[model samples]
Target: MRYPAVAGMFYPSNPHELIEMIEHCYMHRLGPKDMPSLGCYEKPIGLICPHAGYVYSGPIKAHSYYALSKRSDPMEETTVVILGPNHTGLGSGVSVMDDVWKTPLGEVEADKEFVNLLWRECEIIDLDETAHLNEHSIEVQLPFLQHLEMLNIIKFKIVPICMMFQDYETAVEVGYFIAKIAEELNRRVVIIASTDLSHYEPQEIANKKDMIVIRDILNMDEKQLYEDVVNYNISMCGYGPAIAMMRAMKELGYGEARLLAYATSGDVSGDYSAVVGYSSIIVE
Candidate 1:
């Protein structure tokens, strides 16, 4: 019964206004024309998206979802597992939510069955609904999923994972395990890593620093990605989830990744100083 935080500061508070905002982004930004159609390939195993406010990050986020829009399967037929960074610092490794997440669009029911199964298979994951409360990283993604239309017909569950102080080995092992379970269940899943790239740096500096991490990601170099973030003191908030996604994608047979789009808050607000960077990436 915990409705938690609604879209006010992050997105439009009014229901109709919020819907319009999402639609406008999708309509204007059609995503990369050079990329392969979503229907042409196997369902994406994972996606890396930013979680900044709609005004700043919405267009880039739309591009990420556009990549999935061409999938032949109905949204109802797909269960998206959105893995987001825990800004609240509550959960240790991974936190699973059993309750439905409410947004301006409507109530998004959690995939409790899948959550339970993950809990049984992985000792590092636990059910903690509190972790989801007031956490915008995961919540910001639900409206996009709802707007897809087909999602209304499919029963989808969400698993919000907040990784804390976990080593690279642990993340990789967890990713491998999730892939194995998804294969066994014969369920089509999309892993979304909700994170912004760099924070509070000059626009040029932020973009430069984020590109280094992005390059490593596109190369599928998990070690190099981690090292670059640490070595440069990069403020990319979702490095843990990105590492986890890279690990999981490799296990799922996706060896290559492409940078679909990259933009900064400065792009939207026309300010170059102290901006957050956002990028949309897909692994296939």
Candidate 2:
């Protein structure tokens, strides 16, 4: 069983409060919102979201799920593959769990069949739950998904993978492996890369670094993303997962990517001296 490790800290521990926080995220919107109409895209293929505290990043994350809720077919058999950074350094290079994840909202069963197929196709992936035991990057996104289910928008299982080696080569191999699994299973899959941008930097510096990372992602240049992160010292925790998702989308013939929202913790706390950046992006 995968119990929530950061519920009361990163988000609310109570289910009601959790739902309220997510609902409040949807109620508010940042300016110049340009999400496509409901039928604009057949569905969302991948998302890049932040995993910071809900108070600072919830609204930005809402754009990722809101767009998803609009286009997803409620009746389809869908599985969300979430890739997060392994901040805790406890498991394999790529750890995939085959257990139910428990949150304040409820339990989300793992897509074991899909995950097993992934393990077979990718040599890097391992069946390990310890890495996720104390990690919040992937856990923080569950309530948003649970809220969607509560509203009857969509019901789906999950494939949660945590990446400890955020390197471009590993990302490519993993991305292609995911694409192979999707093709083999012929299932509707949505990939989510969970990451928070520049951490504890002044707001201006954080934005500058994050913009570079965002540009590379929008350009769909996985190698460049890795190079920029290293060369420029961008503190994007999940760049490996993001690059993996980008490579996977390209391999699967996806063409467009959109920047839904971008904000800094300063946006909420009014403290620009040292802020963490957050952004929401979708690839299709």
Candidate 3:
């Protein structure tokens, strides 16, 4: 089993404290301002959420999960495919770990069978856990899903993919095979693209750069998004995951995308001098 890597740092280590933090995020001024209900999920697709401390990105991250709570296709057997950027260059260029991921809330099993199937099909995919050991990008997303699980709003398995190499060619290829295999296996899925935008820039500069990246995401233009991030020199941490999710969504025949919320650490810290940008987006 993979244990909580950033338990006390990114979020609370105690279960109760973590639960309280999650509830507060849903009620934060920047968040949905209320808790979510057990509504039907009619069209399950993909989501883009920032991975940062609860104080900074939690409220914005809440927007994506809140939207998920609102709609999907009657949640049956489902798998959430998480794509995150590798902060520590520890393992494979592209890897997936087939182990149960534990958080303060509890354990969420990995779709080990699906993970293995995915490995067989894509030569680029690695079943390595080292890349995820100290990676906060993917770890921080669990509690949100766990919160929804505790609410009984949804039940799920996960396929966590970490990309050490975020080049356009590699990202697109990994995404294509993911969708292809899921379809072949007849697996129902919801994709999570985990990323944070424009690190430690002035609020104005961060906003400007992040908006350019978010626009391409909302437009579902993976190729254009990848190019813009490079050409514009946007320091988005997970552009590769964002592009991968977009490609997977397109392959599944889903089109429309929406920006749920966008904010930066400056909004909460009240320090506009420098901040990291965060955004919540959903594609269906």
Top model number, lDDT: 3
TM-score of each: 0.91, 0.95, 0.97
* Model 1 clashing residue pairs (backbone): 76-154, 111-157
Worst 10 residues of 2 by lDDT: 31-40
User: By descending TM-score, how would the candidates be arranged?
Assistant: 3, 2, 1
Regarding lDDT, does 1 or 2 come out ahead? 2
Model 2 C-alpha lDDT per residue in residues 1-284, reported as the tens digit of each score: 88889989999999999887787777655522433223222653899999999988988888898878776766665789999999998988898998999999989998889999998779989988888899999999999887877776777899898999888899988888888887788778889999999999999899999999999888888999999999999889999999888888887789488899999999888999999999999998
Q: Give me the overall lDDT of model 2.
A: 0.86
Q: In candidate 2, which residue pairs clash?
A: none
lDDT of 1 by residue, 68-138 (tens): 66653453456677777778876555777778777887788766667778778888777777677777888
Ranking by lDDT: 3, 2, 1
**Candidates' C-alpha lDDT:** 0.76, 0.86, 0.90
RMSD of 3: 1.1
Alpha-carbon RMSD, candidate 1: 2.8
Clashing pairs in 3: 41-71, 41-72, 41-73, 42-72, 42-73
